[model samples]
Target chain A: MSEGEIIIRAEGLTKVYRRTSGGKGFLGLFRRRTEEVRGLTDAGFEIRRGEVVGLLGPNGAGKSTTVKLLTGILTADGGACGVMGRTPWLERRKIAADIGAVFGQRMQLWWDVPVLDSFRLLRDIYSVPEARWKARLDELTDALELGGILQVPMRQLSLGQRMRAELCGSLLHEPSILFLDEPTIGLDAVSKLRLRDFLRAENRERGTTILLTTHDMADMLALCPRVLVLGRGRLLYDGGLDALLRRYDTEHTLRCVFDGGAEPEGLPPSVGVRREGEAWTLTFAPAEIPVGEVLAKLLAAGPVRELTLKEQDTDRLVARMYADLKLT
Target chain B: MNIRAYRTAFAVHARQVSRYRGAALGGMVTQAFFGVMLVALYEALAGEGDLLRETATYVWLQQIFFRAFFSTGGEIYEQIMSGSVCYSLLRPVDLHLWCVCREMAAKIVGVTMRLLPMILIQFVLPESWRMLPPDSPVAFVRFALSLLTGFLVIAQVNMITAAVTMRTLDNKGFSGLINLVMMILAGNIVPLTLAPERLQAVLRWQPFAQMLDAPIRMWLHAGPAGEWALSFGVQLAWLAGLTVFSRCLWGRGIRRIELQGG
Candidate 1:
């Protein structure tokens, strides 16, 4: 891809925070205070234009700090990064105008006012034109299914509902880039699915470049085609979610059902079988032998009527990946 | 800090503030109730206004200034102590300018709705003293200058305290200490002239009076207008100096910021 295709470019980016030691050096307490800390160490990644990139990691993996750096909240100490052809720290206003962010832990909405009022306030903050603001509001409301609760105060809304509203608030200006740091944290399953759908539609329809950071692997599988993995303030891997699944596709479990047959026999080392009258369960590590090969052997062994192969989940794949990275 | 950006910040903050309807009412009632109580205490101690050297009118104006100073102080300090400062930092706006613009707008509204009404009620509605005293140009100018000075000084003090707070979670205690010291030295507890001669001499030279003392003096015509303006001049000096110091402290302070578990 050319330079214009890269919406975000970060190289050897790092942020180091130190702890302050109060005056107690040399004599007993006759010196100025100093601090000791290392918030982030050597992190880097690139996000292409109009791609929904998932930043998956555990808590305190420098995900938020990275977002802050990209959004110009914190200046990077080492290395360099560019967002939309401009240095974020130097051109914060321009960067701000182009980006939208929904920090999961905090609500930017006014607690006392109705959701609509906070939307209006954000309209001004992002300096969205009246026509654009109205258009985006309509679009977001329809997309997020926020029509019922638009007039309600933010504090009155449920966590799922509020998260939806927060997304709306962030995108009021129709930013080309969107940063969602755990947008669906603490949401119910149904709400999570709703959010996942909305995010997918938004990315597909508007082609907004999205960087979604979450601990929920379901979110990654549901929305993002590409994933950027961060572990201990370092980029562990950056590729499609399927790539991670393939990297560690060691085991594949199969549920097989036979028609009018006795228990199976002579199951291979690659497969473990448990008989349950008509249905038999088989667990095998596919890395040693392909899952298809194992299924063929099983079909020959039993009068197989039904066979199901449980696909490797991205969540488990990432979990194993993080363990391999020694990040958990 | 981008000046143009803060205009939007101000609007957002105002909307944020308005959503806390209970806070607006509570703030107004708290200020007015405290003002009335303080005035009553002043009257009781002065024995029908003859104990203090200043006239009833002068004391009344002083009471109003005292009320305004503490009320705004507590509000800003609360914002600092609570990790609510995070809200401003995460936004697209500059933290300093956003805070200043928000504060300026809120203070103007607060003075109009809460402070002015209380002063008028005490001086006019129930009719305790002159509704509008005969005022001089210098007193007016000095008073206006003092308000500006007060705003800058208090904001800077708040910023500096908040800067220190970035490194220390318990800096609220330090903020409390500063508040107490400033209130006493700035003569909000009593006119500096009425305090011990030695104490008055020392307190008169400090930054507190620019926060309140000189302005009250100018408002009451207790001192020459030039003297009052000089007090503001000293305050303006402190405001500029403190602001510069605050920003310097901010640079070092933010570098050391280790956001504790929220």
Candidate 2:
């Protein structure tokens, strides 16, 4: 394989967990029960070098399981997965050397130690050379705004500060691929935007391949150009975020204000209009009726003081997709 | 294996322990109090002889090594329960060795911070209450080696317990059972030599005896040359056996690891 090639390839990857149940009392012990949970079923995707892809799913939808499979933390029951041109489960140590992972709910830093000390420890753990380690530390500290909090114990830092420290520590080794699970889960608006900006810069400047899983729509809109949506342990959508929006986002709303408290409209059969006082709102599928023609028809109906057109929001579009897939 | 990675793992635990020096000092006071109580009890029972002195010394040694041998497994249990063990799996190092290094570092820090003060207190006590020291440099070196082996044996047992915790995801019952069993069989509460011959015969071959009883006996030069050699051999053998057993358990346990906590 050449440099900057496909770094992660997974095909028909599957995992099933056998969980014990109903084994409580004496009779329950004799009649032990077991149920199979499908963690990932035929989940497949490919991520190239320097690509920032988002994995989106509801709870228990196998988002975290897929990341764990790819990272070699959990072995797959079937199918194939290759990370950095090697099988992740079989060559986990080798792959771990080339990737950095941050599970937002779990911390990798020493709790009582200073953030800088944790970074230094990670530097040694990854065996990053002195010169490169120093340069990377300086750059990350500046970019992540971690200089002021470097000497603070990790347990003493706020959630945002601790997360920033975590991101800095994960990057000190200069891994080619970075996996972030819910990186912006509990951050304030400003901190979330700052983290998104830093991630974008890291992707642009360092060409780091990032796989992000988050529930935050803003994070998806701001960071990932390509998204993989999983529903019920299956990959439902894998393409550009814009394409997902365009395909599922068909409805558009048109709000109009009539002149002199008068509403007169001979709207098309495809359009549904709601009237309240002098204002009228029309909802229609843009794919069936062109926006230009609709505006012309609305103008011809009556004298319009003002008009506004709004597309469907992305979150609603995603929710609709989930409902359509029966994954909600 | 990455030597530097393991070293850093060790250093991190050591630094964490150092940060909790106040807690360690408090632990020292508690351990010293227990040591004095045990020494007086043994003195009353044994009535002031070499055996009484030896029992007192054993009590002191148990206090010194309590955290090192007994509590290392608790750390693993806590990590497993809390789901932070996922970080260990994510690293590019051998998880077993990394855990061993971390426990070793904690043991070093615990010994340094807690053991010296307890020993100094014992030294300052009345001669009748004082415990005997190692008789010669050779004997002391042998005692140190035996204690080091004892640590390895305890670490192996801890590794097995940790692997079991990884599989079960609940460790309170299992860890408590293991501690209670070790306390009895390893002579932590009372010397195993005082037990019946048949019980001693069985316990001598078990791994728990190798962890504490053998090492303490060797430290006091209480046994003959042949017995000392046998004790060292038995500790080494148990270490080897437990290491293999724990490795297998770890392999199977990791395959089923759920990482339960968020």
Candidate 3:
């Protein structure tokens, strides 16, 4: 798997958990026990070698189930998923050997043991060779700034520190493909930035294929260039973050700082204003009016000292897509 | 389990149980409270009021084996409730084997730390323990193997209960109901011989009688020691049965996991 290409190829991968009528009493309760709760249905997507794909979705959109299916932790009743040319469910052990997953809601560390002990156990669990485990552990520890707390038991570490330790546990095997399920959730700003940097470095340096699913849109912005959108167990879109923006009627803000407290005016009809104390920001749909034409008109009117262009967050763009798909 | 692998997991859990002092004492209190209550009731009924030939000896056995078996698997309930069962799902070790190995180690440390203090306290109250005669060696080496086997059986039953946790969200129906049946039918507060004939016949063959009350009965009187051998033997029988059953259920349950991806 180290040198191989085409890491993931999943087709018509569907899962349905029969939405049983729960909270029913007596006569209804027994009948509901046997009812199926339909969860995911006919979901399909793929990832190429060395690609980082962010899985974007709302709650109950079947993103985690899809990751579980690919990770071989959950078996799919229909469709086929191949990771590194092996059927994940049938070849679960082999598939596990080639991939690592960090679920955000759970901690992988042994709570009573030192973080290093959990790290070492993971090393043994994955059977990582001594030299590789040391190198990778050191690199991740340093990049994520986990040196001081390594000897502390996991129960003693704060949430951010524990999350960093979890990231190390997942990567100890040096698995070619990594699934990060909300690695940055509940992290402080500094921790989040450090996590993103570590991810970017490892991906660039080792070409590790990453499939990240996060509610934090900042995760998508800082790490993934490509995103897969799932809603109501359906694939809404699969492309770059930029392309998702285009699809969602995305808004971009033009911060026009004028010279000597002079306010700028006469923007295009397509542009709408966002207010500040002395400065006014304008937002427009670029697909409706091209950037150069809009800029030509705006720049022609005022002495726009410094212009800052910012787009709607990847999170908002993804949210709008999910709403359009009616999953939320 | 390979001895080496079980050794590592055993050592880890043993250390963890030892480090948590308050929880250990709390467990001892809970186990001892139940222990003292059972012994008190039996002492009140000894041979004429005589429940047995020796009331104090019977009480000591109650303390030892009740604490051993009843307190065996508190963690199992916690594991099932909290979804930490997901941790061992795909591991190379059989989940039941791993749980039994770790829990047995925990029981060894906890019971050892706990058992002696409880015995000493019961011994100091000589008026309460005149039947034991104060020289019992516990037949420690022999009882260790029997108790270990007994403990494995106890823990395996817990695994079977835990296995259902993954399948159903509501577990109030399983363990509570089983505990209730075991208390009456398995003879926890009373002797199996004292129970009705048909019920004792069924209890003798069932696993719960072996888990709690049987071992305590044997330690009190060795005439039942040979009978206790059947209990240990049944323990192995259940170890094998529940392990296979839990594995089959686990495989089925995991196949249907909602994962409920977000």
Candidate 4:
């Protein structure tokens, strides 16, 4: 396949879940009924080969449903979806061979066996050649820092270690597409960074298509340039993260520590300042007042011992977008 | 189907079962104790006769084959409840076939671990308590064949149960009900011969009896070669029919499966 090929395409994808209500007791069965819960409604996006795309949303925002439909774990109730030019649900097995998936909450490894054993089993399941398996395993182990825990049983490993091993297992076959559903969920900071870096390297070196779903904005900033935002079964935004932030005009925070107890004066009306001890935090909207003007005014007010500008936090930016769009 | 994937699945299950040697040993001891108790109960009721001997052998065999063939329903229930069964569907291999291979491997490992010690213990007991070997080499071969076919039928049944569980997303009391019914109908609790003649005739024709009773009876040379041939034919037919039925059910159920916990 050619690089930058449109590997994932979905148009007006929709899923409606009919959930049973109140069937607890024997009498309740007679009163049981079905409720139609819309999971995904007209959600559409396209991902090209070698692109690392992040799928971000709040709880019950149809992010998981979108991933499931693409992965063929669930059939869409309406619309069309194709992975590598094949219908995912209809030709699930055929598409499965070319895609690797890791669901953070659900493990694909054997619980009681050593991590290596699970890797070997996956190699066989994917029918990877011996040489290729060895090469890939070595690469992943090094990248994910799995050397110390390779022989440990999965039940014995910590969640972070197990997640790293799971990543290795999923990549053993060198699939063209990788689906990571909250891969860094519950991981420690170091493990999360390692995972993000490994994924970025994998995408960069192999040109593998990746669709990642995560609640951590840091993960999105570090790994994905393009993002699909879902909310209440609708695609609210699909574009670059930087563009989304700019479109929302998120507020930036400036923390200033002065040499003495001198306070800043003549602050712009758009700037909101809070002080605790010697540290003064200035929050302002860049669209209303220029950042340079805010800084020059602060410098004129006092001899700044230290100054740090925290760009609009991606989390808050996305949160504001969700609020403005009424997606939360 | 991917042969390599199926073989890998089988190997993984085999290793998993082997890792729990303590549990396997514990199960063997428990089954052996139950077998001895049943033998005594049958001897007290039936007196010193061929019926006692046959029933004693049946009891011993039942303990080994019960978990090996018919007890995989719990495994299916667990996979569905845990939502890990999605992996099976995502693989390129046939999901039912993969489950069959994995479960068969577990059962084989379980039977291998328990069969020898149970048989040895039975032999060390009094002659009346000991299980008699197959009547002839042909009977032994036929018994082995029947056991293989029996496993297929049981696997199909388990697959159907798993499909239903996935579709409904609730398996409470289903396993218990199915186990109780299978125990009585498959002749694991009491031999079909001990039942009323009409009832025995009807039960003998059922798919449940084909899983255990037909195989055990054929091994004991309970009927003529023509009857054995008929039993084998019936068992094969059930296997084929159950296979198709379970596959259809699974295909339909998977599309509607809303996997819990992502």
Candidate 5:
């Protein structure tokens, strides 16, 4: 598929899990109950080739269900989805050749075997040509800094090393589309940065389309330019990540540790002030009151010992978004 | 057919199975002890001559190939239980054939490691208690072929169990139940030959009998050619039937998992 071509498209996609419960006693077995749990409902979106898209949501907000549906691991109970011009569920085998998925919490590589052996098995599984396989392996191992650990068994590797090995294994066939679910989970700062760098390079050089689902906002900010947000099994937002963040990025805070002084007065009523143990925190929306105005008012409170201006924590921003959408 | 891919999976599983040399050694000692005890018991109970010798041989063979009944498809169960089965289903290769290859590799390699050592245990025993040789060279050849067919049947059985596990999620209960049935019916618990005359006809023809009971009987006595063909026919029929049934069940199980979330 060419760049900008619609590679993944879903319309009115939905999934409901009927959980059977309350079948404890002999009589209860006859009166068992099934609770319908919504996974995703009427979700619609279009992802073009070579785009890095992040899926964002609170826990149980259908983020995983969306990925599973698009990857053909789970079929939609209602509506339809197409990946690479073919229905994903119907042509899963065909699409399997073109798509690679990595679940952060799971290891796809053989646990007891050396990493290279697992890669060889994957090469055969995807039927990648020997020459292409060699080149891809070399490139991935070099880029992921996995050359030193190729001979190490998967179970022996550290979490970061294993994640890198998994990435290499999934990319060995040079699939056009890559789905990563929490790929940066449990990684150190250096490893996460390296992962993001490699992913950015992969997208740039190979035009590999990436669909990522991560709870890490740093990862989202670093990798994905666009995002699809799901809440309570509904599509809440789909647009640029900046736009989504900006919508929730209304509030800014200024914390001041004053040297024995009275609280700030004469500030606008919109600014929220909370004092604890001589440190006064001033929280206000930038849209409603300017940062300079808040800072000026805080200066008038007393001689400040230490002052820190902070943007909203991405995690808190997400929490706020979840609250705004009633997804908590 | 993706022969290369399946072969690669087989090799990997074989390597993995061979890694547990310690477990195999421990198991060999236990099996040898059982073999001696069973041989002694049979020698005391059965009448002297072909019947005693045949029973002793049957006990030895059962003890030697005990690993064959084990489901080497542990990886299949692990994948399903841990939800990593998603990656397995995502592979472009045929899932059922991949599982079969894995189990076959594990079974063959696992049994081969202890087969010779366990067979040698017979030499240390007294002549009367020792396992007797096959009826003839031709009989030995037939026994080998039939034994291999038995492995395939067991692999299919393992596949069917795996399909059930896909839905049940916990295979311990089902596998325990099935293992007990397989042991009694396949003559691992007690040789079917010792069973009453009335049940022998039906028991010998059952699918579980096709695993080892039928094959080892060939070694004891090579029946008429027509009888041999009939026995082979039963083994092959069960192998084919179980394979198709397991594959169909796996297809349905996959659909359920896809619809319900793994």
Candidate 6:
């Protein structure tokens, strides 16, 4: 509603999916069973206007479910969520004019139609004024580099080109907020970087609030300063990305080639050791035991030939977080 | 809401439907083959007379507009299965009305693309198998209006099929069931006139008959002013009933829809 206002808020939002398991035998056929699977549970967060926030979660952790609920695509089974100060599912059509969404696994464009035709259809559907529509279309086409593929059918475009076109389509209406589910999934390095840059510019220039769900930690690092992490249908963390990473990123690895048969031992049990072809790898959380202390222990145990230290990769950090939370 | 948006959707869907000219050609050939076989079978059983003549026209009309009887909601199925239907749901328009308009466009355009070629088969067939002209100019007019009403009814039927597909997550069972019932009761399998006398009245008044059988009968025999009114009244009644029922089903289905993919 205003600058720096809360544009999106979820309070104890939850969803449980009813899954039916068909019966097997003749008598069992009449006794079909329906099981409720928790999709989201008591998930809550607040997103300010123009803020870019990433949703981090392992598979089936309700990241997409959260997006769907916020976008009015699915109704939450418990609690409430408000977008632009209105309940999304209750006022879905009213909110439709103010928000746009892109799902990476799905194509909103018509497969057999030319890209521009689909754009035109969306233009009319959103009721964008003709003059503003043309101007916005032109700008988006240029920005997303979809100018050359305007006349191509969606099925004929490469994945990278199609995703760019999808971004352009979602932005042409100048929605106040955008929801992207796995927007950069299956994208090449160059395309992913370009997509991140385009999204950043869009947020800056239009002050469009963005809520993106992605498995790519790099995308989260580059685009979202703040993130909400969900695990096992529950909110695990909600704060700055750096803070979340720092909490779990303490685990560090050191690999060193021994000069001879000097066995590396007598180190604290907190540190894990593994033997490779020519080097021994040691892993220890810097928070539990200081990196310097572990290094000294390793040096005393073996004559180091070559050594390198590496922080836990983001993918592993997330995996470890999930493991710690018992979400896997 | 600009009515123009709905009109544009109709236009776009019509364009999409018109793109399948090749399919229409293939369908015409198949329909003509079926038409010839049905007419020959009817002639051998019924002998040459007014009954055979009327049956020939009925058979030809069935073949001519066969495309309309099939569901034109293939895109809805694809969208639902692929989870792309979220885009359709996200649009500001009423989802039910939008789908109705789309299916209407597809049915009209899909049938028109094949109508002429299939009609031409009437002239090419032998004398006994040839389709007859409408009973009179007034009958033709009634037939035209009734046929348009039939499209509305079938469009609602298509939407119902889509709703069922959403509920079941499988279109084949309901789609096939609907097709079979429509073929048997709507006179596509055999003209209701040729059916046993006791069953004829019941079959003629059923909802499925409103799709084409009732309209084609007007073309064969435009009985009287009162009969014309009754014929159209039945069609409109069925259309209204179906529209309401399908809307309810579709609204409920959409509220609980869980798209197939992530």
Expressed as tens digits, the lDDT of each residue in B212-250 for candidate 1 is: 666666665737646655676787789889889988887
Model 2 lDDT tens row, A1-328: 1246898999999988777777778889678698788988998889999999999988888898888888887778889999998887788778877999888987787777789888887887778898999999999999999989998989899999989999998899999999999999899999999999999999989899999999887799898989999988899889888887777766798989877665545667778878877778888887788888888877877788999999887788878888888998
Candidate 6 Cα lDDT to native: 0.86
TM-score, cand. 3: 0.84
- Candidate 4 positional error at A176, Å: 1.4
**Candidate with maximal TM-score:** 5
What DockQ does candidate 4 have relative to the true complex? 0.50
lDDT of 3 by residue, A1-328 (tens): 2244778998888876654464577767556554565556776777887888998888877788778788776667788889999987677766666787788887666777788877766666566677988998888888878999988988898889988888888887888999888888889999999889888888888889999998888878788888888877777788888676677765877777666666546666678876687566888887887777667766776687778888776667766777777777
What's model 4's lDDT at A38?
Answer: 89
B60-90, model 6: which lDDT tens digit per residue? 9988888888766656678765545766777
DockQ of each: 0.27, 0.43, 0.27, 0.50, 0.69, 0.41
RMSD of each predicted structure: 4.5, 3.0, 4.2, 2.7, 2.4, 3.5
Instruction: Give each model's whole-structure lDDT.
Output: 0.70, 0.82, 0.69, 0.83, 0.89, 0.86
Chain A TM-score (model 3): 0.86
Which residue window of length 10 is worst by lDDT in model 1 chain A? A19-28
Q: How many backbone overlaps does candidate 1 show?
A: 6
Residue by residue across B136-245, what tens digits does model 3's lDDT show? 34434345555666676666666666667666645668767666775565455555656678877777667776564555554555544466467667767876786678
**TM-scores of the candidates in the order shown:** 0.82, 0.91, 0.84, 0.93, 0.94, 0.90
Backbone clashes in model 5: 0
Clashes found in each candidate (C-alpha, N, C closer than 3 A): 6, 0, 16, 0, 0, 0
Model 2: clashing residue pairs?
A: none
Candidate 1 C-alpha lDDT tens digits along A44-139: 777888888888777777888788788776777788899998877667777777888888987767665689877876776666778988988998
Best by lDDT: 5
* lDDT ranking, best first: 5, 6, 4, 2, 1, 3
What RMSD value applies to candidate 6?
3.5
